[model samples]
Target: MENRPLIGITTYLERARWGVWEQSAALLPAAYPALVQAAGGLAVLLPPDDPGRAPSVAARLDGLVVAGGPDIAPDRYGAEPHPRTAATAPERDAWESALIRAAAAARLPLLGVCRGMQLLNVVRGGTLVQHLPEAVGHQGHCPTPGVFTRHPVRPVPGTALAALLPEAELAVPTYHHQAVDRLGSGLRVCARAADGTVEALEGDGPGFLLGVQWHPERDGDLRVVRALVAAAGG
Candidate 1:
């Protein structure tokens, strides 16, 4: 793991309060960067910037990570917003979507979590279920807010995710109302929950392109994050 790869992770451009700063701030949970650093990658924050700069940002990083955030606007995928869709982050949607495209074009090792995962699906001409509880008839995937729940996700055999996480089933940190609906082009569903939620995806393109509905940063497992760093180093 010499020559630690530099990884750029997207951030949340939202209002924050810390030490008298109650204004808009580029923020992300420390868990994201902490996980990257623990996995031997230098973590850098990629805040909302002009979408046009995504290519240049992608070119400068060894790997890219699209972190979780608010729900994407339904319009992005040709759908109307569901009542539970909540407020959307159009700015983040535009910026991170651009970054995802840039990363794909460059074949940069990429990982998308939660909202990022949904965006990956949408960017690839796919769609999402705006409300998982409505579709699955249960809220286990996200039973609470500001908290990470746990749910079992079985990896599809012979998939890259299966090879990386050899466990028969993984209980992952979950917190998202949306899930992938239509399968995205050039991407394969790599894992699923007992209730049939798409939990993970992998692309057929070069390098590594993975999207997981759960939050690996919240878990102790480093396999997934390490894999991204490994691919980046190569």
Candidate 2:
């Protein structure tokens, strides 16, 4: 049997209805797992669990993907909630935060998408812009609610991200109302939108730690995901 790299992906806990059951359920878009599988990895859904168990969970996997979800609690990063900020997910926050820390500790290959990207910054003692339109003077980043928009991000030359994405600028599916205001420790900006919104972040230290503000899964662009899978020795 082939030993595919195991990839753990974080999931959302929300009220959902299917067939006759209407209750809280562990939720994750199929695209996430699909992307991992396409990148030659074994997808594992990680439902919210006790934060203390993160180290054990991370130890069982070769790579980790922090799936996108609702906004994180502003208080996690020592900031008050903004009026336009979406409802925060405290439980998810704690669980994913723990997982991120564990993954970094173990030097596991890691990727963060959308909200996941924002959480990475917060986990490392950084701040967020909260509402982006007010700061950027435009709604192009996330123009329509629940609909992903397209915009170009300029990758900083000589970055891991830039190396993966050979193009000077790449348009991607984006949907976010907040962005990294203060970069996290041991992390550096790798890409940015035309408005200067931070689009991609990478670890300054070792490991395949990366956080992308855009939704690479939404477009089936496997370059980033494949990078992680390859880094995991898949």
Candidate 3:
């Protein structure tokens, strides 16, 4: 394995009156870097505004991690915004979509969380359920903020996720209202909630493409990060 795998993490864009803030800004929780570094990988932030530099960005990294953030623009998948939809950034969405496509074409190790997972699905020609509470008839994933809960998920055995986690029953913190409605091509659902919402997906072939609905970073689930780094040949 390489001395240290360089994992490129995608960042969100924030707008300020003075200037355009592009880094992680204070809004996002700061647990990702700690978990990634703890898992023996070097974390590098890739701003969504830097789509023009994705080739160079990909060149310097061994793997990619698409972090959670604002909701993706509904228009990307040929839909209108739902009342429950929060703020949407078109530029960020476009840039991240491009980056996801490039990463997939290059066959790099990728892990998407929350919104990142939705972006990955859309990039692969999938659609999303705009509002969960209105459509799915649940209280929604994150009923409370700044908290974590245990929701049971059944992962398909013999899948990459099952192999990595190995737990027949798993509980993860969820804070998403939007979810994958139609999976992308060449991807298969590896896990799901009791309500039948898609919870996890993996690349059909190989190349280490995995996306989950939960915030593994928040829970210090280093196995996800480690699995990506290992797939990167670290």
Candidate 4:
């Protein structure tokens, strides 16, 4: 087998029904691993569990992808809950948060999508505008469940995302009800929507550490994923 870089992707724990079995399952959208493999990396699904194991997991992987999912518990970031926020997944929150820390400590390349991006920010002393509709004057960020709304995002002139997406602007697949309000420590905004909502952020770390509020996997855009895979190296 070729020495493809191993990419660990976070998953969701949810009550699900499938083929005569209905129970809480660790699930991930097929698009995630599919995109990872397409980018020449081996995909591994990581169910949220004992956070103490994060360092072990991080040490074994070449990169990490914090997949998108439910709203993080506001308490994790010392904020009050929003009426529209979904029920929290404390296990997933703790697990992914620990993974983020471990990955940073190991200087592993990491990519965070949607909720993953928000989690990355929160883990670094940042805050989110829990309900973006009121903050941005529209529900365009997440127009409907199970479907993605489209919008244009521009990459900052000298950022990694800009190099990957050299185009002046990109129409991205977006779905979220929250956004980074205060910049996180050691993080910088790398992309933005026309409405001034943050679209991407990058960390000041040893290797590639990028986060996108948009869904590149769903859109099948390999630029970002390929960049991560290449950074991880085979």
Supply candidate 3's per-residue lDDT for 59: 69
For each candidate in turn, the TM-score is 0.98, 0.98, 0.90, 0.97
Where does candidate 3 stray beyond 4 Å?
15-28
Superior by TM-score: candidate 1 or candidate 3: 1
Candidate 1 versus the native: TM-score?
0.98
Q: After TM-score superposition, what is the CA distance of residue 85 in candidate 3 from its true location, in Å?
A: 1.1
Which candidate's TM-score is highest? 2
The 10 consecutive residues of candidate 1 with the worst lDDT sum are: 81-90
lDDT of 2 by residue, 124-226 (tens): 9988999999999999998999899999999999999999998989899999999999999999999999999999999998779999999989996899999
Candidate 2 ranges beyond 4 A from true positions: none
The sequence of per-residue lDDT tens digits that candidate 4 reaches over residues 1-234 is 579999999999989999999999999999999999999999999999799999999999999999999898888788899998884688999999999999999889999999999999999999998899999898888889888989999999988778889988989999998999998899999999999999999986557999999999988689899999998883
Task: Write the residue-wise lDDT of candidate 3 on 1-234 in tens digits.
Answer: 448888888776664333654444423356877778888888888766657767666766789888898788888899998877875667668777877887877887899998888999999999999887776787657667656566878898889899998988788878887899988898899998888888998888968999999988877568888898888863
lDDT of all predictions:
0.93, 0.93, 0.81, 0.92
Tell me how many clashing residue pairs each candidate has.
Answer: 0, 0, 0, 0
Q: In what order do the candidates fall by lDDT, top score first? A: 2, 1, 4, 3
Evaluation by lDDT, superior candidate among 1 and 4 = 1
Quote the positional error of residue 13 for candidate 3 in Å: 2.1
Better of 1 and 3 by lDDT: 1
TM-score of 4: 0.97
